[model samples]
Each structure stands twice: as structure tokens, then as C-alpha cells.
Target: MDFKELLKELKGNLLSLMGSKFDELKDESKKDVQAFLNASKEKLERWTTLLAEGNITVSDYKWLVESQKDLVVLKGLYAAGVSKIKLGHLKNSILDTVIETAIGFVKPNKDDDNEATV
Candidate 1:
């Protein structure tokens, strides 16, 4: 896929994942998660705009990819930590699936069907 197609697909996938899976969070944590989703979406928008404006260099794309990889790591850690701390308030499996979905967008595998884990 072209860079623009990839970016649009990734953004749509992420927003969908957040919408479907974020409801698994506790009432108190919902706002925090929503805010995070909003911020991430905005960042994606900025990146898209930069690419569309021909302002993005190869180095910038490389940095963006690396940052996304870093985000996957952070998501893994957050899932683990929050799953433990929240106990019954959240479901780790759902969050894990969401993380996997997001990661797939960053480093897509044509073999995977993008199924959510139970």
C-alpha cells in the first residue's frame, strides 16, 4: 500500500479498536483512556498532514515507525500493569487484542486475519 493508504488504514483501525475495546475499562479509567485515544488520533492526523504536504522526509518516516514500535512496547507494559492494578475493573485479554491490532497496523502481517483474542 502507499504511505497515505497505510496511514489512513492505521488511523481507522486504531479508532475502531479504541471504540470497541475501551469500554472494557472501569468507569473511572474511561476518561483517561478516551483522552489517550484522542491524543493518539491527533498525532496520526499531524503525521498524515505532514506527509500530504510533502514535509516528511525518509528520516521522519523512520522516526515515526520507531515511535510506533515504542508505543507497542508501552501498550504492552500498560496492559500488564493496569490489568494487575485494576483487577476486576478491566479485562486484559481485550486490551491485549487491541494492542495486537494496533501493532498489526504498524507492522502488518498479511497472514493474520486480524481477529480479536477472546
Candidate 2:
């Protein structure tokens, strides 16, 4: 598949995963999770469209990756924020893992680097 298609597929998968994770939260945490999911969905849509339209440069991809990383961090913070209200260690663990996995997707791969540090 082409880069745009790959990015689109990735975005879809991430959204699906985020939705599933949000569903696992208790009612009290649902609102925050929903908000996060909505924001993430919007960002993913924008990035995917830009990629598909060939409007994304290498720098844009880098920015996308960074933005995704920030989102993953936000997810983690949201999980922590709701940990008290959620009232379950298992749920907390699941949320943590989901955030970690999401972060992993956009993280820079060691093999993808071409620069040598001075």
C-alpha cells in the first residue's frame, strides 16, 4: 500500500483501539475518555486527509508523529485523572497499556534514522 493508504489504515486502527479502550472505562471516566477520543479522531482525520492529498511533506510527517505522541501522553494523563473515579486496578492497567501501544505506533524507529549526532 501507498504511504497515504498506510497512514489512513493506521489512523482507523488507532481510532478503533481508542474506542475500545474508552468503552472499558466506567461511567465516571467515560466523559473524559470520550473527549480524548474525539480530539484524537479529528487529528487523525486531518492528518490522513493531508497525507492522502499529498500535502504532507517529510516535516509534516514528523509533526504528525510528534502530535500523536502528545496525544498518547494526554491519554495517559487522562487515565491517571480518572484512576480514582474508575476504582479498579485492572482498568488502570488496561488504559496504561493502550496508551503505551498507541505511543509505540508513532514513535521513531531506530532503523529509520539516517543522521549521525555530532
Candidate 3:
């Protein structure tokens, strides 16, 4: 078609496309993002608790179960260790170590770095 006709056709298509219904998708996506953000916030709060309070609360039990699945002995150690400590008495150094360990930090092997020792 001529340039004028083509422009009119394109404009009409654009308008029709923009007008199509997507209310449900918008609402669903909003809910999904909101839920994701809320969950993230809760996780941050849990981590904060871990830092501020060495003793684990019930809310953290699920996370311990899920994240420590492969490290049964370690999980047991944490469970036992926390049990003996009163609430809010967790040492800052211990919390730092836990956070570091959870993020995959490990001590250098003695063979690799002789200067580093237990």
C-alpha cells in the first residue's frame, strides 16, 4: 500500500494490540513479585536474628533442616551447640563464622598454606 495507507494500518494495529486484555497476568505477576519480596525480607530478618542472637529460634529450624541436609554432623553440632546457649548469647565471632561458612568460605588447607594453622 501507499505510505499513508501503511501508516494508518500500523497505527490501528498498535492501538488494538495495546488495548488487549491482560488484567489477570498483571495481577498475578504483582502478587508473585510481592510474595517474593516478602519472603526475601523474612529471610533477611532471620539472618539478622542469627547475627544478633546466637541461639536459634523455632523459625530457623526449617532453614537448618533444608540447608544442612548434606551436613548431618554439622547440623547436629549446631543443634547441640545452640541448645546449651541462652537466647541472645550467641557470640558475634560464631555468627560471623556461620555466615562465612554458609557462603562457601573455607579455611585454607595446611598443605596449601603452611602459615595457616588450626
In order of TM-score, best first, we have 2, 1, 3
Q: What would the per-residue lDDT of candidate 3 be over residues 24-107, giving only the tens digit for each residue? A: 344332332233223343453455345234345323533542452222222322343433242122222223233333222122
Report how far residue 47 has shifted in candidate 2, in Å: 1.9
* RMSD in order of candidates: 9.3, 8.4, 23.3
Clashes of each: 0, 0, 1
- Spell out the clash pairs found in candidate 1: none
Candidates 1 and 3 compared by TM-score, better number: 1
Better of 2 and 3 by TM-score: 2
TM-score of each: 0.32, 0.34, 0.19
CA-lDDT, candidates in order:
0.44, 0.44, 0.33
Score residue 48 of candidate 1 by CA lDDT. Answer: 44
With a 3 Å backbone cut-off (N, CA, C), the pairs that clash in candidate 2 are: none
